[model samples]
Target: MDEEKKGTVHYKGAEGGWGSVRGITETWMREVDRPGALRTLERQNKPGGFMCVSCAWTKPAHPHAFEFCENGAKATLWDLTSRRCTPQVLGRHRVSELKTWRDHDLEQLGRLTHPMRYDAATDSYVACSWQEAFEGIGRELRAIDPGSAVFYTSGRASLETAYLFQLFARLYGHNNLPDSSNMCHETTSVALKKLIGVPVGTSVLSDFHHCDAIFFFGQNTGTNSPRMLHPLKEAVERGVKIVTFNPIRERGLEVFRDPQSPAEMLHLKKPTLISHQYLQVRAGGDIAAITGLIKHILAAEEKLWAEEQRHVLDVDFLEQHTEGFEALKAHVAGVGWDAIEAESGLSRADLEAAAQVYVEAKNTIVMYGMGLTQQVHGFENLAMIVNLLLLKGNIGREGTGCSPVRGHSNVQGQRTVGISEKPELVPLDTLAELFGFDPPRDKGLNTVEACEKILSGEVKAFIGLGGNFVRAVPEREKMEAAWTRLRLTVQIATKLNRSHLINGQVAYLLPCLSRTEVDEQASGPQTVTMEDSLSCIHGSVAHNKPASEHLLSEPAIVAGIAKATLPPNPKVQWDEWVADYGRVRDLIEQTYPDEFAQFNERLFTPGGFYRGNAARDRVWKTESGKAEFTVPDHLSAAGFEDAPGRYRLMTLRSNDQFNTTIYGYSDRLRGIEGTRDVLLMHPDEIAAAGLKEGQVVGLKTDAGDGIHREVGGLTVTPFLLPRGCVASYYPEMNALVPLSHHDQESKTPAAKAVPVRIVT
Candidate 1:
């Protein structure tokens, strides 16, 4: 069969105008039934309704009539689709055959409706009772040593579920609790805690109203979190200078028209310009760009000092509340401009211009995304950003701080509620006092470490709370083979994906209720809580009925498995906690009294409660008892001197997808339609590689670990990218990222910058 006609159209208008409305209409019509779709959307993001499962952007205090964005609508409709993956459907297909399907096609099969066990004889999944499934999982878990089991959590899990997940794992004598945060924001958390004594963004959502300038680095705000455009547009209208640094010229950052505003919808108003200045920094060059800006700021400060004028640097604040300023100053001063321009892909004049905006603004907010965190220098990149903010005393003020834009809905909440591999961070002693068991103290495996352990036959059993572990991790082929070597694997999820098809010696798939479904317990209908990117913990109550009668809440699934796996413990009332989720919240309060005080009562208030940070209150809890500036080693951008044909490839999400979930093939923002197998590159580089537009090509990495790392049949599409830099969609390009390629400190895969060679 001939391939679907691939077309690329350049979009000139603002984002979130008629295009967004049309997208919502088409998604509702195709994925969900008409009247039901409208009803589902009506209850979305309301006070007593389900939360959007797309991005973790904070909800507005006074929401508009329609509170969700286009991607939010897609997530809701995708979850509430009127389709089912029943046992009868599974009987028709074999596991081996289903494994050949694409990731989107597997999820398009529909929501899983029953518990299933792999039957190797027929190479198919057979329906099994919930009790039988739990018992079988418990048996395998008990058969292995406690240290040899890996328990992974997804960001989609609720606070209550994540708390129980950690408790069960620790009580069962294991700390190998790796979650999705290890792949995305682990560096942000680690760096912030060491610098300003907190692991969250310092600014709240309302801070946007008071900022003088907003610096966006490596974040595509329009595509990742479309709802954030509302505040950004308002900020632009107020004359707040928005400086953007991204490798690609994102359409959302250029201009936006709010679909919710009647004036914009009626064509009575023009589109709002978002960025005052857009700097295209090369991939993995964030450190160099930020360093150059700091150098410029320091030079300007010296000039002002020489003229006996007021300087931009907060001298009083730095002396009173910060340390190591002299060392940081000397380090930046020694760096030459030539190195900065070479590594950052920008001239000294551009850096000085951007620095001038920062020097003039009284209060500024610097927000960044995976572009800065998914690199070899990921942790150092975060430290440099903090260093810049501290230089001007921007943090802990009215409208200035550091913000790390998280992708998953509740990823931060998952980590806050004890989903971590480090025992020191999880408060084992406090948990032992509350639950009457000595929690393990040893450091456990992270995402990358878990893969290595599994592959080496060290970890025998794996249980995923709610993520596609095999597909989301690096080294896809090795990960698949490692799964087959495991003694048992269990997936607690809403939809059927590739992870379920790839089986171990004994694999089980347990269907769970989605966030949109009402989770009723013994007491009454329960409400789950999630923490947004701004550290706001809020309640989300589901109003819709369960999609399938067989579905169970994530908390209940954890409880059932824990009860069958461990011996009876009177101190830890697993049954009562599962019966009433309030009991679990009460336990969380007892464990983390400082952060989660009055967890049950406060979570019910309108708009929820803010988990206060010490750094926001101007209190420093670091080793120096004050904010500290640290100089980072300068690392050059990824390039191959040995192989001139090699290009730096960065994996990115299309506009239609969230993380590994592919909603559709069309990325309307980038003007690509009908397919995802395309490499975005510069025209000059395409020609240099002897490749033409629309020509089929292959990508091979230079890891040389005896693993064949290549992806074929990719069409080269010419676009404006930095020389020697290219872009491709993730999970598809995840094959090119080697397991050994990750940050040394955070262990996050450097998906944004991988050296590769293009082959015809």
Candidate 2:
């Protein structure tokens, strides 16, 4: 194919099959030889092998030999790459020059192979010993109040690593444990905690086998978690319906051809049907859509009872286990069909058809992603989903519950192991009693809160476990400008990223082992554990060689800091716990006895062990002591809906990208590639706005704060979409989203729905 044809080729094939094989082959050859790549792939998701460093999809009890997907292959092989960013490379480039590079190019510069410190005198980084780096970090942290320091972590780290990081922060002083979960699923955590008394999904991967239908909201199953396609295809073949509620028509949900299936692969058979119905919900319209579904079911239930003397609503289950039925019924009945149709951009008949599917299924699941969580009314949005499920009393059933499609692998695991801004979420009292020291009780900053503190001169130090924070958040212009105001910044990472270039007065880059690399410690080769989205914990041990000889395990890095920063407590042993990660798990067990009791032992089970949700038994820890229905006063916006020319912008990732890391320029499935500068809009809307296809336009966001927020030179493309809605790639378009544009309750950046206008 020609260069233009390569980027613009429309993928008419299914999600997997030949397309997936081509992708895997391309990435494997680019990163490593086929033999080496196969060697690594053979162990991925196995009983004691390394976990895929991609999405938080659960592992089946009897996993397929080829459990990894294209995304997984890219992530794993990227770590096993031969490229290395040695001291010589760092010495050759200036920070200013490196800051101007593309995100993909920056990470492609390869892995960091040494402990490096930023030298402001030369505007470059120089090699330093781990001891010098740790001591300098300790001295700087001690000079400032512990509360002034934000300890951030990415989801890539292990449970032991996150545990030590949190323990180190608490021993030093505060509970400012901000993580990737705060950016993506904080709405799920906070909302589910209030409604169901659990901050995680109650359904397991096995639930797909028994469920009659699955409802997906805002999450794309194909690109985000390709391995999840197996169960989805199986369910579809077994007569289960898949109903999708998303603003875009995702290729993965429509059709998938499993590459592992020899019959289909050899015969070149047709793709398996994935979604029975795909509804394009308008941006920020999840609440309206869900409300419509509930109303249709309620009306149907009344009709069934009044005419045929039959009942469909689970009145017995509701009366026995729930608390706020009358209020929910009255509030939903008060909502009009006209309002629902206008807000959701769907006709009443369409919604009624979708609702009838849910009403007929004996057991159903509601699976949602950031689409519902990253909005102004995200907290209220989640509760509404639970209300729909509760109308039929789906809770505590075999194949019925809520599922939050957590983006990063083990992001939820980090939160379960005490990485949170809220001090009360973790067992501080037990932590204190076990660790023999008084832990800090004050609430620390979350992602947005931490950024605000940094810009306001309150937070002066940042110690991130493993994320591209500054580049991944909103108000890119302001955050990048305010980044240098800090005194100290420490980032533990496997590769170079944009966040490292925006350095502090005293900055250090600590290189750590990736999940695919063996981590040798005092106790020899150690394995780390992670919790999947279904609350199951699995062990991961690396087989690939380290990217650099100088790299250290995350546990060792955390221990080094703990030893340098704190006066040794009588109960906590930093070195010993890290020497044997089993000690860390034991400590976890003692701290949270109910969920993690005998954690080490249970992790040895064939498919690992369940973290155990209280809601599985209909146990509600909410204030009312039962599952409660929440009714928001009104559907709200993030302060920009009333303004003219304000189009709802949903920022997303291309197929070849993850969070903020770009692997390639082309998103083959979308048919627009080779560059991340195109904006997609409806053809009618473009003509109505006096714009044409291929016109270079800019987007401007004015929150009325008088700050100039604009991104220029985006080539407009026509696509099938809801009116008044446009889509763009994330991190590239993150500049248009201001720091103030976030969910009101959870404070998650509403990247799914930023209000902006197209400019010439």
lDDT of 2: 0.86
lDDT of each residue in 155-266, candidate 1, tens digit only? 8898999999999999899999999989988888888999999888899987899999999988988889998998999999999999998988788998898998889878
Query: What RMSD does model 2 have?
Result: 2.6
Query: What are the root-mean-square deviations of the candidates from the true structure over C-alphas?
Result: 3.0, 2.6
Candidate 1's C-alpha runs over 4 A off are 1-9, 637-643, 704-706
Report the lDDT tens digits of candidate 2 across residue range 1-760: 1122232224566788877788777777776644776878888988878888899998887889888988888888788777789989878999999988999988887889999999999999899999998899888888999999999999988998888888888888899989998889999999999899999988987788889999999998888988888988999999999999888877788888889988788756677989898888888887888889989898889999999988789988888778888898898899998988877877888888899999999999889998889988888789898898888878788988898888899999999989988998988888888888888999989999999998998999999899999999898988988989999999999899999999899999999999988788888888899988889999998877787889989999988987888886778898898789999999888877887888877775666688788887899988889898878655543335645577899898888988898888867666766888888887777888898889999998756778888999899887666777899999888888888888888999988888888889
- Best lDDT goes to which candidate? 1
lDDT of each: 0.87, 0.86
lDDT agreement of model 1 with the native: 0.87
